[model samples]
Target: MKRLKAAVIGCGAIAHNCHLPGFQKNKWCDLIAVADPSTENLKKAHEKFKIEKAYTDPLEMLETERPDAVTVCSPNKYHAEQAIAALNLGCHVLCEKPLCVSMKEANAIKKAADKAGTIFMVAFSNRLYKGNIVAKKALDAGKIGEPFMIRIRFAHEGPSPGWAMSDWFYNPEKAHGGALFDMGIHAIDLAAYYFGKITHINAMVGTLAKKIAMEDNAILQFRFASGKLGYAEVGWTSKQGFAGVEINGSDGALVVDYSDSVQLVTGSTNPSGKRVIRKKVIEKNPTAGGWPIEIDHFVDAIRKNKQPEMGLQAGIDSLRVALGAYDSDKKGKTIVVG
Candidate 1:
């Protein structure tokens, strides 16, 4: 097998903790180059990963290395620009999610990916979770007959003082939006993945806890094209982190507590008119949260000469839903998504 030369476009936390290590672990990929404006981060990554080349400018690295694949781990504002550049350079791109800040940018990236004819995957890592996979499979297998509603909540203490590479996560201009774009994108994307395309979005976004210019918490309600109703709560200010999802169906319900396991419950009315709930742990072992699986998926798609499962359209769709939520909040009305 020919090892694909992979480059990372940012030296941030996502790049360091996820993309870089992911590339290193994949036998079919070679981590050849990395780029970031922060010399401190560049040096740290270079030393830690023992990468061959590092550049202050991503374009420069792309031009010089001409890698077979690239991961766009930059701030939200630079995702589209960097991903488009890599695609135009004939490199398969795995971009971190939220895709881009706006639909226009997302469309631009789509055009570039289409022209390049390379594997362009968005890194929506939540989809790779075992619990999510189990839920999707159960739902598809009709174990949960006619899933009617979905609820997802993802929250963590703000990104201000930790985790993120820098303060960019707190800056509206750089991060795009706040919790909605950061944590909510995952929930939005996952909702669409399970329920189908979101047709309508109504949301309330606010900066209730954090002092950031952008929203720190958001509550989003969505109606899917499949007639499924979904709701998501995302926050960067919570005493304890939380990640959980529930899908209610006619026959039963699938509940996923991402911190632990996935459960399926079926209820029926007994002869005495009392309801009986039968619960089972359909899936366990929820420790599989990382970038390696997603990265490997992208590489496998490239090698097979097939479009990635989470391709450009998925990214565009998720971004559209997110932007719709923002618009709905700003206009104080439900926004329709085509």
Candidate 2:
């Protein structure tokens, strides 16, 4: 396929740092169009990326330009609607995480994708990370045995009015849930990716600090179909940045730590009870890179007429886990995840 035309649906922080620049780096992708309700953001993206078209309304861009593919970078609330619209227009879609605010919307998008015969992918960039990939390889090799248990944690300083000085990140109506929905989905999806299907979950959400309407902190405990137990703790009020996932098995364990390491430790009965023979670690970069590989993969999948590594179902499963967490959080009991 010759250079494919692409459009961006939202001009938010993730779009700026991840999707927009990532696509710009792809030689086979033409960053032709962009859409955002904010005129200022649309203008900046247009000037910076040299995109041919900019619109405050995505429908206008879709109806007028009809690009081959579109990246839905909008908030969780709009992901389903915009993606459904794009798929209905016969365009493949790469939608941002938390596929939709509800399972109904996710299913609708899935149906639309199927009916339109367009590739619909959910962008969970963590799966593209070298560290995560390495972890998967080790697990596949049985380095971590059968994945009997796991613990995942991710936290940040939380989003202000505009963490990047852009806009519209904290509003519940725009963002949907809160920290759990915003950040927890990564861990949720990754666990499913590494171990197995998530069968059930129980969680608690609370607004520990910050005068926000949504929960700034959340704790979730769940079980996967493999009979493996797992827990995830996500928060936006953390003063110290911490992010990592650890998977435990009968014979050994896999740990992905923020200190830049993916270590496989084995032999619980051995002296010292463990050892790290292979260490794969990533240093923190100020710019925080990852999207380049994601965009490259997207382009490759499109050209090859294949599904991206993270497909629509993968995205929907992740969102279901996140929603399950929310349900568990509210109901104060474990909820079964589809």
Candidate 3:
């Protein structure tokens, strides 16, 4: 019932694929405008979303349109500035993740969010999907019985020449870390969603495939506050294979396939002294990624005037692990993520 004006920054793949479309479909939102540096991207946004106003300068757009909400889908290098700008304007912001490339920028944005008093959510889309929801609920209900470990693999054939508008993802200065920061953050946040706070982290990262300045692949190991162990294998070079999430627990193991299916495995002993493995499909909702649900959740948080369940703090925590992984890779030693 509360239809509010909303604008978006960066008209790249994320903006066109999710942010713009999500705002368009939400009845409670009026898709007002968009801002991007590229004329081609702005033209596409206009032709597709039929946006009335577009700006090359996002700050000018924010000042002029003054939308009630904004989604930051810009490059990793620009997230801190754009997000801080929107938050300072007292607008709800759903920032795409790996929050920022550095802790200094992260700290600055945190202060701004603290002062803004508006809902700020990090776009950790993987955790909001149906399969993850079912797995989380079952884990909470003890269906998994004292979950102790998790493994999540999210890999793809790189962003450039495909999903990304630009090749900033391959630039170490822009992206900070390659697949580790890009795809790995999602896995890291999803791990935190199920296991809570992460205490220590170590990783192996390198540019194994594409000749990029940043790493194209990374393997991260995490230790949660609950003493749970987790590993995430993220890369931008997988043509085909496993790229889903799994959690192993005391009772059984829960697996969420790449296509949104949750399977639980429990073991039994046969009379012949052989071990038996039984698999049950507990939830299956094959769909695209959780961008729409994530946007809807952002809007709902605004309407309810409540801080999001996973807000800036969660973003910072996940970033800590991600940055720590980079450090671990550099030092060849585990890093304390306190």
Candidate 4:
């Protein structure tokens, strides 16, 4: 098979740190061109990877290069337009999560993907995390029997002008929402991935850390289709804390510490009737997140003419839950998810 010519649409920190390297690592793909409005970012990428083709406009790059695969790492607002354009060009796409800011945009991308008959995978990177993968396999093997509840928390110091490529993350129009959309969206998707499709959401969002219009912190309560319960928290203000997933079931539980380790947790009563807890280490730290395998998965799907697990509808389903969280915060009540 010939190497796939791949082009990246956004050359921000994410593109540099994750997407670009993921594609480059794949033996099946060649990193051909990169597009970013910031000439500095393009130059930086070129210097790092020796990529020659650069364009200020993504559509120009797409039209001119006509790569076999496209990774949309642009801001929230640009995902729909860029993804649709690439799909129209009959290219397989790997889009960053929150697919777009709204369901309308997701639908548009879906229509384009359907028309193109190409693979469209979302970057639900958490699902590919080593701990999550190990824990999920354990659950599938009945290590956690009949899992009924879950909790996932993902937080960081938040994005700043220094941390991100630009201040677009603070802009309501560009980012749509703050940590909930950026960080929380991952948790939203993970909850669904473990339990099932989320059926309802109750949420609260606030701009506690930054003086921004959008929320910098978010908390969500979820009810899955299986009638299971889940709680998720995502914040941009945390300096330090435990960030991971905990699943409880009829049997023992699985504790997945993000990027760290997976543990099997069980409890028993001592002879004195004192309760005892036990934890057995399962998998150790993973060197990287899902990014590397994610790109390979995308390229493989493209080659096989199959849709990856995190396909277009999976992206949309999770986006629906994330957007519903915002709606829940606004309506001051639980939002029923479709």
Candidate 5:
């Protein structure tokens, strides 16, 4: 097994929480460097991870280290530029979600990835969880029949305490669309990935939080190419928990409750005219280490000369869903997503 040298950019909650720890545990990776604009963040990451090479500039690290791959954990605004820079430098890049602040920038990064012949991917770690994967398997087994509606809910008490230090994530200029871009993108991508390409969207957004300028809540409805209807509700306003996703189809239904356990229903109908099925509490693994899969996947793509599972084009397609939702919110009309 070839161990790839990896560098992480934007040492914040995402870096500390997922990328660093994930890389630390992975035998296929050598966690080399980390870069952030904040000296405080860099010092903390270096100390915690015992990383020797820490810089305040990503480009500086890229030029000096020439890593085999890099993870861009920066604010939504910087995703495209930094990923493109890494790709141009002949390194595979694993970018965090939303892809970028806009579709134009998303396309730029995709083009750069294509031209450079390097792997570029967005770290959509939600799909890596056991519950999600199991749910997908059950659906494909025809347990869910023809998929119809998808109901998704992803929320947290708000950004973690670590987020206070990364205030740029809340700024409209930096984050593009607040909770919508932050938490909503994950649900959007996961839905599109399983249900198929999003063909249309209708959305409404509002800023309900006192401190945050961006929409703390959003409601979006999407039409998938496979003729599935989906609804996603997101909010930083939730005081309950993180999130969950439920898929309903004609023959049966699947519910992945992140709070409890993953459930599947099929076969005989109950009093409520719903199928009665089995539910299981598969051990809840840690989410903090999901980024390693994204890292390893990108590296494998680089080594094999193939596009990654969540390639640049997939990122672009996912971004369009959120962007279309935003457009719908602004124009108060449904938007067609290509």
Candidate 6:
């Protein structure tokens, strides 16, 4: 098997912790180069990963190395430009989530991907979780009949004091938005993945604790095309991290406490006219976080010439919801999503 040559465009925390390590772990991938504007980050990544080539300019790296695939882990503002460049260069792209800061950029990236004839996958990692996959299977199997309502919450302490590699997250110009774009995007994508396309959105966004230029917390209500109602709350001001999703249906309920486990509870009426309740707890592998799975899936898509599960269209759809949330908040009313 010919190993795929891979390059990373950013040396930020996500690149360092997930993309880089994921490429290194994949037996079919050869991490040949890395590009970053910061000399410190480039040096650190090169030294840590034992990468042979490091360049300050991503375009130069793309032109020179011409890797088979590239992971765009750059700032939110640069995702579309870098991904489009890589795709135009005939390289498959695994871009980090939220796709881009705006719909125009997202559409441009999608167009580039369509023209390039290469796999373009957005890193919506949550969908790769085994628990989530099982939950999806159960839903599809009609274990939870007619899923009508979904609620998701993702919260953590602000990025500045913790894992963020740079302060760019606080800048609206760089990040586009705060928690709504950062942590909230995962919830938004997962909601769409579980439910369906969001037809309308009502949202409230504000900087409740953090002094950032963008909102640090957000609440979003969604009406899916399937007529399912969805709710999401994301914040960077929580004292501790919390991640969970609950789906309520007419027959039963599915709950995924991402920090712990997934559960399904069902109710039935017995022949004696007594109510019966059954609970099943699913144990998820603690070691699985989906980064490796997503990376492997991207590589497989490239090798097989198949569309990725979370392709460019998924990225655009999720971005539409995120941007819709911002628009709804700005207008102080519900916004119709196309």
Task: Give the TM-scores of the predictions, in the order they appear.
Answer: 0.96, 0.92, 0.96, 0.96, 0.91, 0.95
Q: List model 2 lDDT by residue over 214-268, tens digit each.
A: 8998888878887778888998888775488888887677777754567777643
Candidate lDDT values, in order: 0.89, 0.81, 0.89, 0.88, 0.81, 0.88
* Candidate 1 structure, TM-score to reference: 0.96
Look at candidate 5 and give me any clashing residue pairs. Answer: none
lDDT of 4 by residue, 1-338 (tens): 68999999989888887888888888888899999999988888888877868999999999999999999999899999999999999998999988998999989998999999989999988888888888888988999788999999899988885578766898889998899999988998888888888999999998896777888899999998889999998999898888999999998889988756789999977799898788988988732557768888888888888898888988999889989998899999999996
lDDT of 6 at 289: 58
Candidate 2: 10-residue stretch with minimal lDDT: 280-289
Global CA lDDT of candidate 4, please? 0.88
Question: Which one wins by lDDT: 2 or 4?
Answer: 4
In the range 1-338, model 1's lDDT, one tens digit per residue, is 58899999989888877899889999999999999999999999988999989999999999999999999999989998999899999999999988999888988998898899888899988888888888899999999888899999999897768788777998878898999999999999889889899999999999997777989999999999987799999999987755889999989999898787898999898799999889999888553754658788888888999887678888899888899999999999999996
Going through the candidates in order, what is the number of backbone clashes in each? 0, 2, 0, 0, 0, 0
Model 5 — which ten-residue stretch has the worst lDDT? 280-289
Candidate 3 per-residue C-alpha lDDT over 92-141 given as tens digits, one digit per residue, 9 for 90 to 100: 89999878888999999999999998999999888778888888898899
User: Mind sharing the TM-score for model 6?
Assistant: 0.95
Off by over 4 Å in 1: 268-275, 287-289
- Candidate 2 runs further than 4 Å off: 161-166, 267-289
Candidate 4 deviates by what RMSD?
1.6
Better of 4 and 5 by lDDT: 4
3 versus 6: better TM-score goes to: 3
Candidate 6 on 27-74: residue-level lDDT in tens? Answer: 899999999999999988977898989999999999999999999999
